[model samples]
Target: MSELASGVQVVRGEMQPWSDQATPHPALAALLTDVVPANRRTLILGPHAPQQIESVLAHSADVTILVRSVADAQQLGEDFGPCLQVIAGALDGLQGEPYDVIIATDGLDRVLGYDSSDLSWTERLGALAGLAAPDAVVVLALENEFSLLNLLDSRPADERHGDDEWRPLHDDPTRPVSVDQLKAALPWRAEVYADFGSRTFVRADVAAAARPGELPTRLATAALESVDVPLLSPAAEGVDSACRAGLLGSIPTGWVAIAGAGATRDVYTQTGEAVLTADQNLTGWDVTITGDATPAFDPAVVPTTVPSGVSVETVLFRLAAAEDVPAFRKLAADLGEWATTSRVILRWDDVIFDGESFAYGVSPWVTEEPVDKEDLLAAAWSRFQDRLIGQHRRHPWPPWMLGDDLVSAWLGMSGIEPPEQLQATSPDTAPAAAVQVARGKELAAALGVLLETRTDTVDVRTALAEAEEAKQELFELKGHVYGLERTLGFRNKAMKTRENRIRELRGQLQRLTTAHERIRGSRTYAVSRVIFHAAQVRKPKTVARKVARRIRKR
Candidate 1:
């Protein structure tokens, strides 16, 4: 077999030991062994033998154990040999990472030198729950008998162990608490299991049982039994008292029986005798009685007259009885008038009636009377009319309130202007029709405004049309200006080129004229020289030579 299987067998054997040996309660052993899987993180609280720690370690390899003292945890480690992580400090050490399972053995009730005045078991349990993951479970193994004893012991004791030492014991006997008190201290939805032989109680799902007074001892016991777990003996006297007080009954389907003043023997006998002497049905019902230990019924306690103004309490009370009681219907009318003049607050208790009795108090003959069909129908109509009128006055034209035919007549009677549609129907409809009439007028007013705005919008459209035409004309003019600017730029460039060409031609003509003048001057001078030389040479052979010679010499 595998090591885990072998370890589990060993642990199981240790739990149930030889028949003669004193073993831990079977339920408790099963709980500790079955709750966590092997190799899971577990936090064990309280004092236990090294063998107990070894047994848990044998089944699970990973375990973080906690104990009240360092010596105890050290001794456990010496035996378990490094397989244990022991925390030796306050329970506050349990605050960080959420553990898979938190096992609290006997240590839950043991608080060392700490003030428990502000620290209740419920609060501590909540603190433990906070350390668990959402799906994590916290197992608290409390001694069942010790629970009651601890409650009583938590009061006071005279013994002195040290300055911080406190005695967990009480002197008062009348204040003894039962398992119910412990159950009341748990949060809602927590499961409580009792190991009668070991005198131990296991609280699972601590988070579920956090609400005060929601879990009763009997319910807790029942829950345990549903899981096939056993519980210690119940408090018979307490159960009897609850039954006698009418707080307990057979399991009800979809509803529960509520205790009333009539359930008590004294109240039933005295009040029933007084009211039932006039009716025969009182003896037939045989209603339960209740005791009134107070002094004789005082007339001063009952109000002789109602106040003038309307009260919500009185209104609701009368409304509740309006169908069956004529006096209640009359009171309702009076209350409606008063409500118009005053403010009122309603208390639920004042309006709720006992299902069996029509009378105000408990009595056998106080059975509810059959409703007067005709009176109820009339009252319903009257009250509805009154309520409608009141609502109309309060809110004549709520934004969502539509004016119908009924509202039209009401507005007409109230001298309010009705819408055209409602005005046409006003003569034929009832006064209660005002609600619809007012709504119609409001709708008409809104529509009229919408229509007027629509008409004005047409005029605005005409002006917008003119403005759009002007904008188009402006855009056309801008396009023309842009075209002109481009043309002017091209024309300016052409003019610049023509001016450059004219300047170049004028320069060339000036150079040519200078060259021609020089050439002409040279040619004229050479020809004149040639003619003078020839004349001088030819004139030397004749008489003319003298003139020529003179000319040549000159």
Candidate 2:
């Protein structure tokens, strides 16, 4: 035995919380349940062990953790017990027992300095390659280099890890590899699976079955962080199609490559998990799944919560039975066509049952609630739009681009023709009426341009250009006026300060005059004046001499 193996200490610390969550990472959980079989002896190669250890151990399969650190080996051993044997110091440290599956969630090139072994990345893979049975599949996770998210919001290179793998613009030796590199590194031909979070857990076949651009990719920004920016940006548009074109390299946040085995029946075991839902489409409500349970779910019955003004109601409804059940059941039975009859806006919540779960017929009379809700919503949206307009009115209006896009979109919709301009009357308008009001403005602007273009071909373009220029000038003028108004406010404040200062000076002058009068009225002032006049009279002879000098100078 090697000197390093002699001191095979145990890795300590609880490794249970990783898979304990009600929603485990869908990819990681799927990889264990689907790709890694229940009967095979598996080898987990890691520097720092994966959080999905419990998911792997859940199958009650024989498992071994390959590590170069005695501490890691010891801690993992202590947490997982003797069934999970840990090999210390090297990949080849284990005697020639063939592993049915060799899996690594950590990328192949990540540092593996456990117990300070001098193994290069390629060398470790070679040893890992040596241990696998000829038919044994090698599954490893790597960052997909050409993911669409890479073109979108990018994080700092050094900071990106597994989740933020679609960062780094430059080729990082330490980072996840391209599909070609991953394929080249393995001993046999590789089958690649586009993976979200770069975790090699979900079956590639499952990921592929999703619609193009439908593969899950997360934004670099958080929900709170993206308040000013919508979840859908220019980069986000038609991403489904782009991903579908190159499903292997373009769309997945990361990828899983299986060298020995392709996607087979065993690969789809992780059909439903909570984390799988994290990649759901950006929709107002959840689940657009079709099909009636007993027969076929009618597409017409699905409730599509459309905007207030639009006339479409596709919300899904289910009918509960003669018996009360705690969980929801599909109304695909006798009531499927009945619910679509539109007697009442039926929904899961709307389907009220008695305490005994007895079925009730659809309501005979419909309430005016939907219309009332529309009115309330319109009022609220008008208030919100007013607030936005007020804020932007002082600043430059959001790029004419928003207005331009709105004009095109509203005009394209059938049966919308507004006058030259729209005037909103919020007091009496229904809630749905607010959307129409906005549409009126956008359509009016569009029609104005369309009319101008058709009226005179020669100068219409020039006139329209001038009109756009004038509109931009008006925006600038508004901004300038707003600045001047702010300055006027300051001037008013300063004028108030000046008036107070003048009053203070007037009071000081009044006090000084009153003090002088008091001195002049006193006997001391009269006596001093008389004495001073007499002194001047005595100096008259000196005055005569002064008068003679004055005459001589003249």
Candidate 2 RMSD to the correct structure? 20.4
Query: Cα lDDT of all candidates, in order?
Result: 0.37, 0.44
Can you write out model 2's per-residue Cα lDDT over 1-554, one digit (the tens) per residue?
44234334323221211211112354455545555667678877764334467777775478876655455556666777766766654444555678888877655543233233555456666767788898887777665556555534334445445531221124445343565566676677777665543332334544444432121211111111212211222332334355345443435556667777534321211211222212222332122222232211233333432111100110111111122222221222222222222322232222323222212211122323232222222222233233233222221223553432432322222222333434547766544333545533443333233212122222233355568999999999999999999999999999999999999999999999999999999999999998888677867788789999999999
lDDT of 1 by residue, 448-544 (tens): 3321212222222335555898999899999999999999999999989989999999999999999877876897768987888877774456757
lDDT of 2 at 209: 45
In order of appearance, the predictions have TM-scores of: 0.28, 0.45
Against the true structure, candidate 1 reaches a TM-score of 0.28
